[model samples]
Target: MTDPFAPLPRPRSDLTEPPDAPQALTGGSGVLQGRMLLQVSPARVGLLRPQLDAGRSGLVLCGPNALQQARRLRREEQFSGPLLVDPAVYEVRAASEEEPFPNACEDTFAFDDPLAVSLAEQRAMGVTAPMTPTGYLHAEDSDALKAAVRRVAALDDPQVVFAAPVDVGWLREEDSVRQLIACLRLLAGPKALMLGGQMDPLARHPRAVDHLRRIVAEVPGAALLRTDLAAFGALAAGASFTAFGAGSRLRHIVAPGEKAKTSKNFSTSPHVLFPELMHFFLGKTLADRFAGADGPVCECASCEGARTLDSFASNAGDRQARAASHNVAVLMQWLRTLTAFAPGLARQRWWHERCRTAVDRYPLLNAQLQQPNGFKVPPQLKRWALAAPASEAALPRADAKDYRSP
Candidate 1:
């Protein structure tokens, strides 16, 4: 019998590539090979050249505002790496100060009327931008998603492809998965799945991760990616590769569109995102501020010489690039570490163990996964998380109002 779960066929052009050391990735001589991509805005694309030169490999992602800039770079023949364009069609596509992006609808039908608004007033705050037509989103029905794919594909680069219906978080129905799978199967090539917006990667809605894993297995050639470091744990679930948003909070999601700074109280930068935690700290300064006499907590290439408190005050572009570079390092190291663990569930277990340790080390980090604003956690994932070793023991007791991760 044909196995539905069997691996899918590879792309004709062979879009995906072998990692720097395939043998290191897979114990087997001819084993696994893949690329770790970077999801950056047009402003950050320049960072790619250095990363590429540094022996780091990954794709680049951009929003609409930077699309032309990215294209110019491509046409200039400056960057030879894969480039991805995001089409945030989950909601109304509109122009914002940041760029032209698909933003959450101003008024979700759920609260179209004041009556319904009051009925669920408590949840009103939880509903973020891009509430999506049916309380979630899908590119299958979006012409924008289709058009984006065509536009990117038309770029005539095998390395390019568009990511749509980025998240299946609100896709609660089995048919939803099946339908989306049908659309996914029809994608041209160099397929990539994005876990965008509202997803707490560490504490993914249980079903969303399952759906994601299913996609990875079914389309073995597709890249399972997340711009947000929060969802980096998806790597454990059999994701081929993950791009760090420079670990800056700016590397975020929306249906494909997806925020921010200070002094000592500004230890975290609004734009500078930290992994394992939902909060953003003051930029390089915060990172430098936290630096002990020995040195900054992060000695990543980007963080070097950034130990000065004023260094954190570096302009957004410089600081963003530095933060992004550091995140690339973090993801690559994990990729290598997981390589030792064969493939499949074994890799996931390795990832989970590390995540478990991190959560245990800093319980506050779990705040990102808590799905604040009355948002319910995916039941399946909540159960799965609870089953982890010391899961409940490590969590703040229900009565504990304060959680300080010292």
Candidate 2:
């Protein structure tokens, strides 16, 4: 039988180059700290119009909203922070397609179509836009890769051309990984850059860490490292600073789990998923858990604290809007923090205590509730975390009010 997970060969190109060392992230950290984080969803923007005008610092436009809000902000001259738009289609194409952009939706679905708002359009809006390259990593043709790089570079703003590194495990082939890294080097040119991707500790073993480190060594600029909030603790068991995305793991909850058995089970519902959790505790938990491992990272306001996570989670109207806005806030806060601390150990001790206690109390969460198979914590990881100095026993109990972390 063919091994489904086998690494495929990379396309031959003169573009191939060895990975560069992790560029020290210094300037942007301070800009991210203590700012209002805003996200664009149809509903959040409508209800939380006040937040947008009230010192909001960062903006994250995902899915279809990326084009709409970006244009709106530009027209109204109301946007503040450097807007980083990660078109939802970018990830969709990367994760769902096997061949180079097999899922490139060529219609007017808005969010799914990359051409709707080209790099050129972003430049016209005076928006500091960044294209999350989903197809570049997997493209086989040299011209296609060059064209992808050119498309992002055309925007004429370094911040606008951001690239998401390898994430989906299904797309983790060596050639694809190498191609994506190479494209970053090319896209980055000389200016500093930042890249982020998912690295689940429970799923990504020591070998995976080594693999990540190998990838880290290749990038030229500050690379944002993201993981499941709890997983971030596991990854940074001893590192100085760790970066988190409100640790919310922003994803579509359109599908139901293996045991879920109702029409409502497969539909989209924010209250049930707690999307706001990503905004509430992702960064602090990461910092506190690893003793400053996430010491200086960029994200929306929830992590930075401009708006209370609880308030965002329980907003009276538009759960998706609140969550999305919170995510934007967190991203901005992260960028500010990175600038302020600029190489300061991104630290957090509070989250550490809570996560530790939660695991001890609710072992079921650590289990793979998301996976089809029954969840089981790997004994090796459990033992490894236990053996460490900031062991579970050293941490404090979780507070009932502190649902933000863990």
Top candidate by TM-score? 1
**What is the lDDT of every predicted structure here?**
0.41, 0.38
How do the residues 1-406 of candidate 1 rate in per-residue lDDT, one tens digit apiece? 3347634333332223321211112211011134455666666666644544223344444444544654565566465454444333333342222221232435556335421232143122211011111111343344434444333333333322334435444334466666555544444344556544543433444555556556655553355544553234445454444555543333444542342221244434434434333234456534443344332354434454444322444545566456556555445545555554545555555545555544443434234334233122233333334334222233223322221111
Runs of candidate 1 with Cα error greater than 4 angstroms are 1-33, 48-56, 64-68, 71-77, 87-162, 186-188, 196-206, 230-232, 240-242, 247-252, 255-296, 304-321, 339-342, 363-406
**Candidate 2 C-alpha lDDT tens digits along 261-362:** 232222232322122222133322222333412232323433344333333223345644655555544333333332232121222233333334433532
For model 1, give the 10-residue run with minimal summed lDDT.
126-135
Q: Residue 360's C-alpha lDDT in candidate 2?
A: 52
Alpha-carbon runs more than 4 Å astray in model 2: 1-42, 46-57, 91-117, 136-162, 165-167, 170-183, 189-218, 222-249, 252-358, 361-406
Model 2: lDDT of residue 201: 29
**What value does the lDDT take at residue 42 in candidate 1?**
66
